[model samples]
Target: MQDTGSTVPRRQLGRYLLDWRTRAGLTLVTAAELLDISHSSLHRLEHGQTGRIKIGQVEAACELYGVPEELAAAFTGLARQSNGKSWWHEFGDLIPRDFDVYVGLESAAVGIATFQPELIPGLFQTGDYVRALNRAAFPNASEELQDAWVQLKLRRQHRVTRKHRPASVSAVIGEAALRRINGSPKVMAVQLRKLADMSTLPNVELRVLPFRAGFPTGLWVGPCVILDFGITPAGSPVEPPVVFIEGSTVGNLYLEKPHDVERYHRTYDRIRQRSLDAVSSRNLLRQVAKEYLA
Candidate 1:
């Protein structure tokens, strides 16, 4: 079976199906029995692991779960898109095992809030910066493979750059990230300048958490991204917000519970409060870039 490459529609479809099934008070086994499928099959379908979801099955499940007509139609549409390929699928092997899921969510999000303490965020990285990071991470990889990874990074940036409905970005970077040299002084200079340039976009807001901020939360805060899907016409969120915590020694975490999401939001709010404003951040970036050149 061909991998579906972590398509967003499939994940959204699975989440909706799972929520409706639970609301209907049906256990997985019971739901599977009612839907005439094996328990494991239903499990995969609800978790977005099944490849090529059938529209008929989705429609049947929606009816069985007593899903509203409008939502049922939306569910069916998601099923239709479940088999479609995302651009990131081409570089699947080059990315981390679970990172594709993050890419999918990022693609579908209407707004993104990112906090990076140690390095520049991927969406704002320059091509040279990306190549340098990839080379460091995969020193033995071929030049062609590194180039492919750079392309993938550039493609991800389209979320912030596209002319139509560009995703709104609010990013807070620790002073360490600005000072840390990824490839070389020249590379860092260029990267910092690029960051300044990107910050000028109407959809992008950049802030700097200077060293003087002194850990506003009084604890170590790692890198995290909060993704917000836009709401529907009825004023209901299309999907709940998710907090993605990356760079754990174990593995990345995707926090979806309401309380967890709220906690991250509060944490981000506090961090943003301490960070320099957008104008100050832009000035800081240029100053540091000039320092690197000197």
Candidate 2:
């Protein structure tokens, strides 16, 4: 998958290379002539438009610019980061690259908040529900891809179960999620039971947004996820908070903008207000499960 998000490092590397070439008194055309590459090809490489960088080309550029060993190594690291096969590639090409970034971030998140309007969140999905959902979402996906998706979904369980700083999760699910039948009655029964079990985990908080709430904050926005990473004091690595919004075919990541983060935080709080308390939400899920038995 090609990562549309998290391109900051890529851009940084591009600027670094461009600056070096300029300091070496080489114009884009001259650099292209010297490297025996087209002007546009050199431009794209310098601008980070090229998704992958050739080690030889990078080394040649470094030599031309007399780049310090340390800086050259750093640039090489950035290129390597962008060149590796996507983590989701194991699921075949069905999962797009944008989603691969989300998977990477989700694995590193120390806390998460999600608003799911129609279906159970992926992290809590049962194997059968996961299989059914993936098939519906990707009708053309191969059986191997579907199986890989299921495996990945189940692997998310470890994030919330690990002993060292388990991820703290708070989810607001629509009541419709519980009322709708995703698969067979047995499948749903087991799914609901799994939800109940997950809810009891110390790090997980579940709330249901009942229809009667009447959109308290007008936060009828589609489902979204907010992930927060553990922050350290000054001198430590800086990992910023990020919000992810998904559409029909792509996903967007909002970071590096304080206003965007603040807006989402307010929106999340408003949505939470419309949701039932944890106890009530669990009761509602239980009632819905009983209805499935009838």
The numbered model that scores best in TM-score is 1
Lowest-sum lDDT 10-residue window in model 2: 86-95
- Writing each residue's lDDT as its tens digit, candidate 1 over 96-147 gives 3432456667877999999999999999999999999889888999999899
Mind giving the per-residue lDDT tens digits that candidate 2 earns over 1-294?
Answer: 654434434544666789899999999999888888888988988776887677677777888889887667666655655564421122334323423445656876788998888999988889999998888889999999999999998998789877888899999998788878887787787888788778888899999888888776754677888877767776552356667775564434335355876788888889888788888888877777777787
Model 1 per-residue lDDT at 287: 100
Model 1 ranges off by over 4 Å: 1-99
Top-lDDT structure, candidate number: 1
- The models' CA-based lDDT, in order, is 0.84, 0.75
Q: Give me the runs in candidate 2 sitting further than 4 Å from their true place.
A: 1-99, 234-237
With a 3 Å backbone cut-off (N, CA, C), the pairs that clash in candidate 1 are none
Look at candidate 1 and tell me the lDDT of residue 160: 96
